[model samples]
Target: MDMTLKDLRIHKGLTQIEASRICNIPLRTYKRIESSVTYLNNPKYQYAFELLDKYVVNKNNECSFNSALVIGAGYVGLSISVLLSQYLDVTVIDINKDKVDCVNNREPLFKDKDIEDYFKNKRLRLTASLPNKELYKDKDIIIIAIPTDFNKETGLLDTSGISNLVKEIRTINKHSLIVIKSTCYVGFTDSLNDKNVMFSPEFLREGHALHDNLYPSRIIIGGDKNNKKVKEYAKLMQSCSLNRAKTLYMSTKEAEAVKLFSNTYLAMRVAYFNELDSFAMNHDIDAKSIVEGVSLDPRIGDYYNNPSFGYGGYCLPKDTDSLITQMKSISNSELISSISHSNQSRKEMIAGDIINRLNGHGVVGIYSIQSKKDSDNKRYAAILDIVSLLKDRNINVIYYQPHEMSLDDFKKQSDIILVNRYHPLLEDVKEKVYTRDLFLRD
Candidate 1:
């Protein structure tokens, strides 16, 4: 029996509008396609049909690797190291001795349940060491998952570490396939001028790093797609993932573009919703109602729409700024350029709202500093920006995180409490709590 677009969409748990949006088609066109009014031969519908056909759940036979070396023990590196160790003899090298010790002890340097579980339950053939030529030489595959933080002064991604490391790796081991998992500028790999090197962008969320690696949505390997080593590396990654995610091969520059564009789009969505909340606040409208009403439209769905002080985390701020910088030479970068500004405006708006609520003359208590609930990372957290903005106005602020202080004591010490996300712990003091967390979720 032949399947229609609607059938495929329904099977995927998507509504017609959601499917249309995914296919980048109009609702009417999608309706026509579903009703068999549109011909499959039509060029407009061909790509959508192809996309649907390619949407099959990927299931591939497991592949194995003999040995691998992963540099950097940050979330990306550590998770990849653990995942690969399940099949390959993996060695993780980091500059930080504490991080190495933590990994050696089977303790994650950061908060991640999956990593903890893997350490406890899995017989991972992994070892941690400081970078050395001896450790680098014997590895069949060397993966670079180092940080490339955005440099505000240079107005570009700081790839100095990546550049220096690649040079060192080449010196130590000339034949090992180098896979870069770091977020870098577009054309960075092309600039390296090495055919043996490939770029494979990681798509793991903070706090859920290992879980995401195990059940990835997709895996993208960017390099010589026809190369045997490249294909083998892709297969190895696919086998490690619990889902056996669909893998895509493209040029390195395209892979870099994919990473930047994907993150920027998420940042844009966050800024869009924050702006919407700002508008609602200004107009005295119900922001939650507006968000819910808009989200009911299948195209919008209902994830990552929660409003906060701003879109501030390790990735979004830097990635968005890097993408904006990358687009400087381009003619039409208005929308891309506006994302960072929008995020900044949202932070300012949030601060202004809090100040207005306090009448600019009361002790304020900060609930937490982490970017998101249950996350230990405070890197570029939106709440930090809001706190800075308030302090600039000479408003005295105190903080009480459950991690640091008791809730009863926190309530007694503050006149007004500022919470980014509402918690049940604050229920007793809800009257004194000021928050924009309408949905009560991250």
Candidate 2:
């Protein structure tokens, strides 16, 4: 049944101004479209339809609580914000004004297919704003998903951001549960010593964050299982999840250990496989053939074994380094430290091999700085280190930037092009391309 635009607007429970603001249409423009019979005849009608593809659902009151606030609008923060907003009100705040604006406009801060879909069609009681104390107070739960970058100088995770935020939150809101989702140094959560402050580490991939949250592998909430607040928050998370993920309760320190150790173990696997690939390359054997043969073992499995430049991303690099530093107290195993050492050696080996292939003097071009084909995130990418190594050897290296230079020009200028991941765009110049991507999957 075709209804008038006014009737449709009323059905969606939006006032004229509210509809205009949420849809990003000017107030005056919306009013004209509503009353004018020429709306279908005018071009403005098409724009209005596109905006109405999604509508805002305000102040959802379905879950354990009505309100939650997430700190840091980066990958972790924004992903969880979109996930939790389905069941309750969620306000995502960040220091960056542009990121905040992006969230408020219902635009993705980064590329995630699930998040993009949810933003357009799902019932999201989500908002984004600058960091405000008033927004922090009165929320049932305050999730701290801010970055705790590993500080090279201090040899510790720079948790000053989380520490200061906790201090501030305690001063204003005493009842709300403050959940720490940021990756931290082992025992960093217990070091805070606040019963209200709990640590729950997120085990999400780089590009597939929200999808993982919806179907989480496990939900580990660190604190006393007996505590009402702890149980309530756990319930809140389970309610949001599509799968009934196993919920594990443990000490804050143990939960912290789980996150660090898990990532370190994955890094170790990467280093292990990368070392194997290095061996295969050294012997001039088919790397993929050997990889497939070894992966045939049932116990070893056939996952996360794709060879690359090295395992260099936000979680693996930072968490492995932090874990290596944290493990210095009791266990002094050279093996744990060597995971990072192995990665370094692998990059150096790769750089040397590339230079040797160039026969000492030639301009080398880099295809992309990103570790993955789809991802734009370049945090701690392995290519950066390789570039540094090449520069030290007096090798002239150029990067293929889409905006500054054309693809054909980039291909034409360099004697040999280095890519961490292979792409079809460079297929025409196959012999000139160099990469370790065996399976051609990220």
Candidate 3:
């Protein structure tokens, strides 16, 4: 089969318009090129490959890699490894033994639906402990997908993991192009001064991480242009992506800033809606009705306007907090900081309200701590703030969902349930329960 430019571009997940913009050509011209009628003679097409490296695990067919090693078993790492396994011999390395074992057994670590199939067919090799340096020592690419959590006290991500990992990679495998998928502050990759280093931001949501990887919104790759390795790395990454999304290449610091600012803006939007809901709630006004009316305007749109206690997730809370702290020299991010502060206040108020509603100290049952309805995770869940607040007031905060905790005695001792969202079995304790889930939906 004669592979047309459109076929290659589409397999790489690029729309004609996106291809045009990436190639710096007219949309009409790009369309004809993607339609296979014209050969893509534009030099800008090379830029797309660099951007594709930011999002895709392996380039489609441009680069030859005998084996690939991915560190970290978290959602981003797992997703990247699975995608790469489709085209290359891929092995996942993580410090967590259970996570590696689970992946080896075809078990879903997080709530991803597509992970099992990736494992069942023996596509990706999963392993605990460090990847054998002698084995991946010759691999073309070694991706760092480890968690870089923001320290609550320092207002910066604890990139010690990344730093150490990079040092190890440099010591063990100096030639492998190191792609950092973990989110970090702006100029993070620049500080390391590694010509092979590239900052690729992950845009995957918690529950739909793999699916998002399968059909990404866009791919971005950023590093210094002087580094030929970075350019080749980007090309390899673009070749591996879904092949239909647009890939944009820029500098490393710009990629880092894009990740932080993107999340901060989302936190700002969440805060905006929560503030609106709080206003409606205090005045005994119908929040949903008012929100519906406001969202009907085409300019504003309707999605992501739902009011919640606050924005608390693995990504939003730390990213916003980190961005706020990183704004020491910059003066423009005050509004973003306020959005994060507003979320904290909302959580405090929700806890206070629940506490005040209770007549006496009883076993106050805490429902699913996961902010969203369908998720099984509770790390950085907003409900934990409620737990802390109520505990300070001498209320017994008994957690019912063991999915988030190791405590086994929780189910046996709770008289009053505090659920953010309601369920049918909660009817028995309905009179004693206190919740802000007025509409019974997330």
Candidate 4:
């Protein structure tokens, strides 16, 4: 199939404005070239395409392994499958029939726009099926991206999802190079004692999984660096990405710690900003200005500088807690240990402030239970905890059901609306809305 200018741009991980800047074309002209076939036939097309060609992934270069078996149709698994499927044939297996059907129907299981566009336009050599022993045979590589839910009882990750599946896949196919992309505890790969097993942690955000894969910050191969498969797999991922990403090879245990530490650091940053915002609120100072001023330092970048109720997404809360658990056995980790507690206190303070706003009596309408705007994922959103705290205080909470409750009706029904991230839809009811989102970009 002939690649369109849009396809090349997306694969190159360049925004329209960036592509325009590189090709010395106007942004409007670039958009027209990408959107219209007639405009794409113009002379501008050749210049733009040729300029961007070197930056895009070259699918012409073939790999040794043509087909891959990916376990779990979750974010990481699905993104990797789509990335490799651009050049290699990939089959994804999930126990969830709904996810399998969605993949087969070219429907995205989540809210990633890149995945949606790829499903609609790109003929990715990808398929999905339910887990079976017969399907696991003869695959070049197998990736495990299942959820490693935090076990509060044990104070560690419940990685049985990965452990059990690895054993099962080994029973079916011992030769396939199995890669562990799931978040695992330290020594997880060592615990398996299998030569083929390796742990390569995924470091992508919730909604932008596929885009991050295409332009990864770093490609890490966590296993015996000298192993032939490990080196080849690194080359495969490097070739598939938009740019030449630096690759790191380390022991699986170090890789496991890298995932935990990286996420814990992010959670720490979130906690830091939330605490700063809390202090600002206590003193009635301008939080945004203080945050912006402090973020001027290059080390303290403004990426995760936005403050909210707390860091309660899929990774931050659980990973921080798990790391704290790991630190308990050591002699000193007081700094690393305080992140979860700070998060909890922030939530309580926010809840208390909300109650003060209500004067201890009012119905609260939730704009969204999701952590971020335009996402269906609510795994551990802070709003849910806030709602629970409100319920404990005898406050009624109602959700914005667009199909049933009209916006005006929803606004009228509640004395206050609790939104973690502000949306324009609630502009009419701004007085009734309560949000801590100062920077407005989630």
Candidate 5:
């Protein structure tokens, strides 16, 4: 099959510079290939394509799964259910009636354009139902996509939900391949009593879950790599994805570590940039300009470099803390511990800066409570913490959310508005707004 340079780069999970280096070509030459300025017959283009071909899936080796039951209606589970439904008889099980109804009605529980489009146009062989013992026994594969939220008091991921689900699955079905897609502590898969159990780490962004799954950077499956069933499951996933992402098989413990460490590293990068933005802001310098200069190094590309209140999404905070909890026995954990601290400090700095701008006594209007724009999920959002901090200082606050009040009314009532990210609605009251969103993109 023919492939574009852009497709190859995304499949290999490499930046243009990295891909160019691997192909032994100049950056400009790679750009030309990526932009299709260079013809496919060109020697350099052919060479680059040949190098990327190593990562592509062999379509002839694809496998088919008859049936799959995915647990949870959240992003990870829902997206995986939809993807698998294209080729397999997929049933999504959720405890929440609302979520089940929404899926049954061909509606997405959350805001994802790709999912919305799929529901509108595609004839998916998918269904949703409440948890039942018979359903577990009927499916050929059982996927555990339940949430394992980090319990702050326990200092670890609350894996009770996963553990309970695994037990129930084992009791009902001894033949199904049980895959754990939830984020868990290291060595979580090995601790499970079932030999058929596996851990497959999911890397998806909020509001883009399905799209990311369709064109994933890489697919990592942890379990018995040599097992025929495991290999078949991996190939099934490969055939289902749009990109046919590069697949890796490793020990269960290593796969779990990959999930935690991958998220923690992203958290660290966010903290690093936030600290840079903080320093620039304190010294009255342009944070954006500094970031642009720094990102030109190619090693630190421009993606995910935008400044925010802090890294407060579903995965980063929990995964970082979970890693810290797992690394307690290790001697050198200062860097791991410091990532959480840096994030907290970043939020505190933002709150303090907003307060300082208002002279400590004024109505602070919050634009939205969601973690980021285009996302309905506000769990662990930094703005919530900032609101609490402002409230403790006896500062009056109002939410400018459209659901709560009209934009015209919100503008008239608030003395100052605080937005985590820039928006066109805040353009009218630019002088009254306080935000760290310099580049305007999320």
Candidate 6:
């Protein structure tokens, strides 16, 4: 039915101001729509209304406390919380009370422009508790989004967390469909013989978590083909969609392999670009221009070609290591090991270049120690290796982020500023600043 704009506004239960705020529409235009002075005659306005309708469910009370719980409140967990909120009453349980509080207050613990509105609008509930047996008992969906750090010495993922969560869920929520979102080895999920279990691998980037979840390239679900639970779970996922993304179904083992191999491919690309940049830097060539020229070719379109210390983020580092470790056990796969070796080599090369640049006995200030630019996070930041390399040679290293550092105080304390990217603030000290960011954008 083509209802009047007033009827639609009332049905959505939004004041014109509130609707304008949520939709990014001009307040005056929204006011005109609400007042019947103007109609949403254009297709663009109609499309905007439809987009909002998809996210903010009209039947507020119809929310089924079809209880869903996300085990960890990290980026992936947060994204899933927002995505699943439409179909189920979702809650995120985390160890950190601060993170839980942020979620409960509908504030993002991390910065993601796409999810900020969802958080602010209380799309999902969040809590932090010592995870009692009762909490998981009645939940229909339980997703594990915890970190699985790779242990270099053991050559395996430290997945005691996953094991513990599985045991606990089996005891408490035997009927709940357990979805493993944590990245794991190829066959790990298949080995778990739990009845209501499946793997749904996440393909989210570090900064663009929610956007990727909402508008995913593809949704990969894995379980026994005949299981009703698996099929129903996939349908439930589709029903909550903000983006009409594609879906792929496979066995649990294949799904797990897809996640690992996908991340490893990204890591491989990063390593390739970093090495390319290194060669260009050695010859004093414009790396970015060369990359732009090469990428303009249809086969090698420009994306993810920016160079850095190495690929060291939440997914790429650990997934590559785990895939390599798992591949090594078979003795048939050699390429996976080489890919991992190349990653390590890239980091080593960056460290070697830094070491060769500095006088072995001076203090060097590291401007922004983050692994990625324009991000506050520093988990597995590749700069740590270069820092360690410098420290071992008795070179004192000072850390400072532009946002965190006071301009006057930072200049007073540092001998040389080692920046990944050149900044105007270091104009006077440019001679002492060492960086390879010929074209700074990550």
Best by lDDT: 4
lDDT of 6 by residue, 215-282 (tens): 67888998875777777777666555445467788988899889888988888888887878888988
Which 10-residue window in model 2 sums to the lowest lDDT?
A: 53-62
Candidate 1: segments with Cα more than 4 A from true spot: 1-64, 401-404
Which clashing pairs does model 6 show?
A: none
- Which residue pairs of candidate 5 clash? none
Candidate 4 per-residue lDDT, tens place, 187-277, comes to: 8789999878888999988788888887799888899988888777887898777656888999999999999999999899889999999
Task: List model 1 lDDT by residue over 1-442, tens digit each.
Answer: 1345655565455678877887888989887767776456666666776565344232222343589999999999999999888667889999999999999999878888888988986678899998887887877799999889999897878988988988998888888889999999898889999898999998889988888897788899999988888989987886665554788999999999999999999999989988999999999999999999999999998888888778888998998899899899899779999999989988888888778877897778988777678677878888888888999998888888677888888898877888778878889999988777879998
Residues 351-407, model 5: lDDT tens digits: 888788779998888877776787988888888888898898888999876777899
The TM-score, computed over Cα atoms with residue i paired to residue i, of candidate 1 is 0.85
RMSD of each: 11.1, 9.3, 8.7, 5.1, 7.5, 6.3
By TM-score, is 2 or 6 better? 2
Q: Which 10-residue span in candidate 5 carries the lowest summed lDDT?
A: 54-63
- Model 3: per-residue lDDT, tens digit, 185-258? 88788888888888889998877777677667778787876677777666565555554567778998899989
Show the lowest summed lDDT stretch of 10 residues, model 4: 54-63
Clashing pairs in 2: none
| lDDT per model vs. reference | 0.84, 0.85, 0.74, 0.87, 0.85, 0.74
Q: Which candidate is the best by TM-score?
A: 4
Candidate 2 wrongly placed segments (more than 4 Å): 1-62
Clashes of 2: 0
Output candidate 2 Cα RMSD.
Answer: 9.3
